[model samples]
Target: MRDYLFPTEIERLIAAAKKSPRHGVRNNLMILLAYRHGLRISELVDLRLSDIDLQSGRINCRRLKGSTHNIHPLEGDELRLIKRWLRVNSNPHSEFIFVSERGTPITRQSAWRIFKDAGEKAGLEVNVRPHMLKHSCGYYLADKGCDTRLIQEYLGHKNIQNTVRYTQTNAKRFEGLWR
Candidate 1:
């Protein structure tokens, strides 16, 4: 009944997305960025090329639902993937980073379908909805011992309460209680 994907599951999804017959690079980058940056479907689909600063290895995350917007540093892998996608992009003129075959910005529905299909292709046990990527990012950061406040800001949560749940279920927090 877990809603978030483990790191291994995320890796599997990325691999599965890469195997797609069309737009494989685009699809995988979508998943990777969504998970890495804790982006909601709307946010992911709304991303623009101008939001990323390749020279600085950073991205301006435009959060929704009144959350605070922040710049997130892109990992080397993410940067490489993004560069690869850009080189193979169907339409270089499109404002959005991710685009459909027609060079239109990818819709939220299309992004959802891409994640779901990648999940199925990865043989994931849980139904992979786009939001799960966001949740997975939160949990991953929590499990890694990242400060709750930092995780909150990273996920763009206006309230710390929203971020606590990720840490609440982390068994590692109680690992030494009996000792």
Candidate 2:
């Protein structure tokens, strides 16, 4: 909703990805996934190697907070980046989708730190976190005319009201037109 990162913030992340050190590639991929899929930080951390399907351009999300397991589609650059990251970093021993330098699953704290560091390096004015990326995903989808019911399904929102809140109405567009 309004809590989501501004468009400029997304731009900053993209710039950061371009300049990030090689080791930070996984973090960048996580950022993309969070924003693209509207996933909670907990869900992101719980992801496993078996969740993603590059060939089919879909992600299988398990044990979401408010809903059952679901399949989400990937599009465009998000799909491409994920494939690239997987190709470079996939490891048999790692059960997690994202791993740290130690080859262990990245913790929630580490995920937060990665986002914070990336935002700083990208010169973003606002602090971006994993949740904010999820919010951004919802906002963007709503802005693009996605239905609230569909958004609810995609975001795993148990209540339609929660999904409604994510649809940001454009004040400027309605200004002086509505009585």
Candidate 3:
């Protein structure tokens, strides 16, 4: 079964990630963007400096699972988080936005570790992983009553079937079912 965090859990995860002093800035940036943009761990790790445009507020996500690359909007607190990390991070010259302590791009395994660490700190029952953040993004958007096709495009899903699960999983949609 696919895993997804509720909106509250998402917030809790963010808080837990933020509470960590070690690599907190970078971890927050990575987790926040993964949720905001529905990015796969590979995409998150592979993102380059040129992929984001702060002025235009756009993220050019390179879809990895047989989907076409697409440009997505960037705004709100997510943008601010990116800016804050960039301002304080020592590796201003690194190609990748999410870098390791050594100033090199973090591997997918390291990205997974970041999410796992946050899950432990957040006291979540489910083991959090990078893809769960992406699923949270999908569920969050779906809960907001976003169109399925739009979510499909936003997520860079080549098949609508893959995106259909979000619609089925939107817990808010079933509110008052028996009432």
Candidate 4:
């Protein structure tokens, strides 16, 4: 099976969102967080305001497939962007972070639309799906010399086999081998 990875498209999506009247900071933040934290579509839509700790810059992402949870921290520009996004979009009493204009948590279809529209605007030829963000995160970490065990933990994958693909795809790991 092919892994739909797009670390670069993720950046392009953020850039394109800034130019869009509709995409706004919230949409950009959602896309960034999806890649940074390896979140599934359901996890992204299911986030609640209370699950975030602004002072600590931590997000308690719900690992949907395994019925577990993992804590991921925001760093650098992501932390700043999260603060800005919350300032504009958060309803203090709302049950979820990302919501429709009706103030309800966005459905899976809406999440799908968010990525698809942004990908198109970014000039990406591939059909964008939210899961690609997760794959990008995994591949990114692997390519950056992060351990497979850590990637598995960060992604909340219960099986190591699921995480092994990233190790296989990291070409840099083979660099300097003939030296």
Candidate 5:
């Protein structure tokens, strides 16, 4: 069984998250940010409002597992989604970027459930977990022929070996071997 999702599957997951009857905006943003920034579930749940700089269209990703933290550019869709989420958030005064309906900070388990449910709703055959988003990000970049060093930096991998897995499995690496 493949551990990571493809870009199309990621899109399907995001679309499913957006259709949640409750916490739709927050859930959608969670999946989107996690995939875009390659955030671990812990990092994603720990995010606070202060980490975001909407004016500059950037986000300060505080990574986990001794990974290097970095600032990532926010895409136009991400910017718009953040704005919409902020405007409609249930607890306007909450410090956390993502909160439960009752205004408490979201727990890791809940975050897991969000992805699990979204995956089921999306009709994906494989069981999906939150970390798949991170894996998907790595694989997606590798497939796109992004430099390994750049991917490592973006994903906050301190060791090149960790980043190499993504490149090693890349089908593009053998593109012209038989030609």
Candidate 6:
């Protein structure tokens, strides 16, 4: 599948989301979580109240792709966003990390729609999906010089080869050097 929003596009989407009255907070938080955590929509939707440990900056992801559980570290902007989201939305009775206005856990389809709508509102011309955010996380991490083995594990890819695809250096970056 085509990779989702580019870095610039993601920024624009977040900016647009910040202006939305109804979903501004939730949408922006979702964007931050997706890009920073490399989480699939299913994984994101499945997040429960107990999965996050803000004090420790860790997130526990359960039943990831192949019915496996993993614990991932959160840092930088991702951790901050999660903390903010929790402060704004958390309730004693709710178990899901993200909830709809009706107080139901966010569905995967809803998550996809939120990202797509946010991208359109931002005037982004590319297709945006929740998985694209996951791809962006992997791509950005690889670009920042993260080791492939680590990136592979973080993304929960069972095969190293699939993770390698995320690390494909942008050919355009080297085009100038060839001249």
CA shift of 83, model 6, Å: 3.4
**Which is the better candidate, 3 or 6, if ranked by lDDT?**
3
Q: Rank the candidates by lDDT, best first.
A: 1, 5, 3, 4, 6, 2
lDDT per prediction?
A: 0.95, 0.76, 0.88, 0.82, 0.94, 0.79
Residue 38 displacement (Å), model 3: 0.6
Top-lDDT candidate index:
1
TM-scores across all candidates? Answer: 0.96, 0.85, 0.91, 0.91, 0.96, 0.85
Clashes of each: 0, 0, 0, 0, 0, 0
Predicted candidate 3 versus true structure: per-residue lDDT over 42-75, tens digit per residue: 9999999899899998999999979878999887
What value of lDDT does candidate 4 attain over all alpha carbons?
Answer: 0.82
lDDT of 5 at 141: 93
Name the 10 consecutive residues with the lowest summed lDDT in model 4: 1-10
Candidate 1 lDDT over 7-76, as tens digits, reads: 9999999999999988789999999999999999999999999999999999999999999999999999
Per-prediction CA RMSD (Å): 1.3, 3.0, 2.6, 2.0, 1.4, 3.3
**What TM value does model 4 have?**
0.91
Instruction: Tell how far residue 13 is off in model 5, in angstroms.
Output: 0.7
Residues 93-120 of candidate 5: C-alpha lDDT, one tens digit per residue? 9999998889999999999999999999
Candidate 1 regions with alpha-carbon error over 4 angstroms = 175-179
In model 2, the clashing pairs are none
Pairs that collide in candidate 4 are: none
